[model samples]
Target: MPFFRWARIWVLSLSGLVLTGSIAAAAVPQDMQDFNHYTFAVMWHPGVCATWSNAGPACKDLSPAAKINQEWTMHGLWASRPRSLLAAGMNGPTWWHYGCYWYNPEHALPKGSCANPPLNLPEALHQRLYAHMPMAQICLDRHEYYKHVVCFGETPEQFFPKELDLLDKLNASAFTAFIRDHRGQWVARNAIMKAFADSFQVKNADALELRCENPSHHIHELERQGNILTQAWITIHKDKVDAFPAPESLEKGRKGNCAEKIHILN
Candidate 1:
C-alpha cells in the first residue's frame, strides 16, 4: 500500500535471481463488459522485478534502475462483479478472469489484442506517476490497458489515473505503514489484514486479500523462510470509491498465493 525509492544497485549478472515459471495465462475477456465492483492490485516491485525482469518486454530489468526497498507499486485495476450479480450464479468461477468469452459474450476480445493509443498522461501527472509507479515497465502498462482497462470503456488516460488515485490513498494509510516498518520480518496474517481495515477505515477484513510468493526465487538473500507479501487485492464498488465495500465472500481458493505468517520482503 505504501511506496518509496532507494539507492541504485548495479548487477554484473542476473544469475543471482533465476525465475523458473511462466507468466500466468491471462484469464480476461476479449470484449467489453459492464461491472459494478473493482479489484485493485498493488505489487511489490522488488519481488516482481527480482524474478520477472527478464521474463519479457513487459517486465523491467530493475537491476540497473532500481535499488532494494520496501514499497508496493501499482499493478493494475480490474472491474468485476459481486457474487450476487454473477450470471453463472454463485457456483461459477469466482476467479474473475477477463478476456474470457463466457464472461463477456458480446464483445470479448482476445487478451492483449485491444488497440489503444499511447497513455499520454499530462507532464505533471507523469511526474506523480513516476514517483510511485517507477518499476512498471511500458510493455506491462500496455498489456494491462488492453487486457483489463479496455473492457471498462475508459481510455488509458481516464482509467490509469483512477487506479493511481486508489494506490495513492492506500499508500497514505496505516496498512502500508505496517509493511514498511516490518520489512524482512514475519508478520501475522490477521494483524496485516487488521491494519488494512484500520488504515483505510474499512470494516471487513474479507475485503482485503494478501498475496505472497516464494522469496527465495523472487528476492535476493533476504533469508527465505515462509511466503512473502508480493501483492494485495482489495475490493471496491464502482459506484462508491469513497466507501469500501463489504466482503464479497469470494471463494478462498481463488485468492492469491499468500500465507498465514507472511514475510514482508525488502
Candidate 2:
C-alpha cells in the first residue's frame, strides 16, 4: 500500500500548492470548444487510456467507475463502507477537508496508451498519472448539487445554461460579493481549476468569472454543490442518517487532492 500512502501524501501536498502559487493561472484550452463536451470525452468517452505502458486499466472502464466514486465523495462518504461514518456524526470543519483520503489510489494512477508522445519524456508516465488524478475539494452535497469548479477561462455561470436566470437575478453588487466569497473555494475544490491555472495562461479573476457565468460548463455545478452539502450533512447527522460515498469519490480525489497526487505521481 505504499502507492496508496504515496497517493494520500501527494494529494495533501497538492492542496498546499493551490494555497500557495505553485500553479499558475490559465484559461481553458482553446481546443476545448465546450466544457460539457470535453468532460464527456474525459468522463464517459475516453477513447483509450493513452499511456506508454498500455497496461493500466482501460480508460473507458476506469473512468466510469471513477466518475461514480467522485459523485459519491461529493455527497460525502469519505470512505467506502456499507455505512458512512459521516452519517453517524463525524465532527469536522468541512466534509472535503479530509475527503481525499478515501480515494482509490490504484484507479487514480494514469493508464494511457503506450504510444503517446508524452511517454517519451523522462517523467512522462508520472506526469500522465498526475494529470488524471481526480483531486478536488468540493463533492456533491445532500441536495445532489455540485459546486462549480473554476474552469480555466470561464466563470461558473458561463458554463451552465441553467444558471442564466440565477445570474440575471444577481446584481453586480451581489455578484461581486459572491465571487469574492466563493472564488477561493472553487479553486480549492477543482482539480481542473488547478490544472488550468498551473498549465494554462490566464488570470485567476478571469477564470473565476468564466466558471461563474455557466457553472455547468465545467461539470454539473449543482451536482457538485449537492455532493458537498450531502457529505457535510451526513458528517453532521451521521447518527440520524445513512449515506454512502458517491462512486466518484471512490475513484478519484478532488482537484486539490489530485494535484497533490500528480506531484507525487511524477
lDDT of 2: 0.23
lDDT of 1 by residue, 1-266 (tens): 01001101110111222111111223223222445566777886655544443534434434423422455677777766433235534323443553322223232334442232345567876666656665434545654665555433465556667777777677767777788888667788888878866765557466677776654363434325437677788766666665432233221223555666777655
The number of clashing residue pairs in each candidate reads 14, 92
Model 1, global lDDT: 0.53
Q: TM-score for every candidate vs. truth? A: 0.65, 0.17
The digit string of per-residue lDDT tens for model 2 on 180-203 reads 334224233344334333332333
Candidate 1, superposed: residue stretches over 4 Å from native: 1-34, 53-68, 81-97, 100-117, 216-226, 244-256
- lDDT of the candidates, in the order given: 0.53, 0.23
